[model samples]
Target: MRTPLFLLLAASAALAQTPRPGVNYDEAKVGSDPLPDLKLTTAEEWTQKRRPEILKLFEDNVYGKTPAGIGAPKFEVTATKTDALGGLATRKFIHISLPDRPAWPGMDVMLYTPNNVKAAPCFVGLSFGGNHAVSTEPDVPLSTRWMRESKEKNIVEHHATEATRGTESSRWPLEMILKRGFAVATAYYGDIEPDHADGWKEGLRAAVSKEGANTVWKDGEWGAIGAWAWGLSRIADYLQTDPQVDGRHLAVIGHSRLGKTSLWAGAQDERFGIVISNDSGEGGAALMRRDFGETTAIITKAFPHWFTPTYKSFAGNAAACPVDAHMLIALAAPRPIYIASAGEDHWADQKGEFLSGKFASPVYALFGKKGVGVEEQPAIDTPVGDFVGYHNRTGKHDVTDYDWTQYLNFAARHWAK
Candidate 1:
């Protein structure tokens, strides 16, 4: 006898809520070994003594080791317009070329800096769509790179067209950011590595392989996330060279997968003074051990190229992983980092993300800085923290005006001196 349709639906909903052992949810159990002692007298001592071990653990088990010299990319300015955004902003397009791979299409960077500010504190991030999608400005060049097409978004034949322009504008409020005296820099993530499993064949990984046989990453080496994070650092390298940008005040920000890239970039590169992750759940700001939503197994299976093969070892056994998201956040010691979530985005595990920030507080204390001040997750839209900040806004898993407001406020507190 088959079950009734209504009964099947009801059972599915019930199962979703029920926390299955070692699956959707895990017992909140911390390891017996304590976190690297944040009680050390000086932040310098803590950095010198404990930071390396934590960094190594994450590289070994999660994000994988980023090869050195990934930063040394040549930059070329392709175009510039002083009268963009109705004369309120200056738009510049840059081309980033990797060594020994001049034939590769390379990455394109779009920068919008307010004309009023001589040296603006900029927000640098990787975008899911092409740079053209960030704004409606006619000057922003269209990306010719391979894109994950969406007919609804007007991206036809795996290529970006004019109709896709400004589609992602909600995620990147350029005019608002410019009016607030901040600059925004963005690059298409696919230019670094396409999102598909075989994307490595056309990206930096392939470029590295062409340099020498030994440079090629073995299986389980750095994956798409690492390449995207490395791409952000290359953007940072260009930002440091520009006179319009205050390199010391650079902040790296991202949403969803790019948010994961932002955290990893901030952790590896100290040049980013402020790091912000919006709905960067699961492999991002959320603790892996929580298993509340978007479990390790789920992510690995969905995107096999996002992490190393070593990460598979702990897919169903997150408790055995030597490092957790909290440790990844802690790696940004003393830097002002903000982790935002959405009340409706349980798949990103809002609660798990908040707890990671809370657990990372002790490391901030070592630098005489504060962390998320509250013990419990605050009410929706209530932003909290000192050096480490978080807010689960009343929305879904997308960046919005409210999220940007909190980030601007947080940046003002730290960057506005």
Candidate 2:
């Protein structure tokens, strides 16, 4: 039977009217290009041939290639407290800078190691708030850099105040983590560059660019996410030199946007044995093709500075994108990776995050490692999977004790041996 021309036109109009700004909950309405295959049979083939190709696709199409000419970071230990955090741990503040780039404002790194441990496994992450915001201690110096304005978070006039200290302490359970025999190293993400569009002018990106502040970013040039990932790597370099840290067991973790940063950092640098993402949507663990809560069109428009300018092309036409979130997860193959979501974080596409890990399972199998084994998404608060652990916790988008508990357990399962 042939369909009438008018009826066909009506159907096309309805399709065009599908809300681009609205959330999509129906599976039938979702569309995705088939994931790029993990076709190689042996680890050697994957490492030598296929792996590099996938990596290049991401470098060129998504996060952009990390620039190579930046000078090595110089570290200065400005303060050391042997009896910090109520004598539960030793804390140190290290000022990191590039000697060649005097114009750039470098970062301050805060590290805490357990009191009795000879060598403790470390967690490396970037905080949206500064080091002072992460700890309740009064001695921790307040960050003087520009911060995203948030009256509730206690930032006034683009600067963090005394009231901002320990505001994000709940997100970072330092006392619990230290008692569990782990060290923590963190730096403020803004220290690399502020989150706004024009932030690059004052950051390392401009300092290293040949054209300086006036330089226009090319399509595949590194973006804010890449710059932040580079900062994380520099912190890792310093950890390797610390005798109190178990450098071999270092884990990279982040929540929300920083979660996206950690994934990119872990993919590029293999020094992190465990990788964790919490509520990282859109450009993070959620599949970009899924027309779910947050879409490619939305993220690219709102946070264009976070990715390669070429990424903007995939908005509303995600099927044409060469890579998907699953490929990003695959890049961390054989390593213990954990993707976490919250019950109320629909904007992050919780199910989509789980599916990325599921799709990446084949790569893990190639290395004789397990992945998210369940065929379907588990109920909220019920943790699942093996090497690729996942848990849709029972709350909103923020990180909680439940999420941290899973990460600690997952890290122990893989690293405690």
**Backbone Cα, N, C clashes tallied per candidate:** 1, 0
lDDT of 1 by residue, 35-93 (tens): 33334456887698677877777788877888765436899999999989999999999
Model 2 regions more than 4 Å off: 1-21
Task: Look at candidate 1 and tell me the lDDT of residue 333.
Answer: 84
Error of 1 at 413 (Å): 1.2
TM-score of 1: 0.90
Query: Which candidate leads the pack in lDDT?
Result: 2
Clashing pairs in 2: none
How well is each residue in 287-366 modelled by candidate 2, as lDDT tens digits? 98887877888778767888999999999898888999998998898788999998777778889999999999888989
Query: All models: lDDT?
Result: 0.82, 0.88
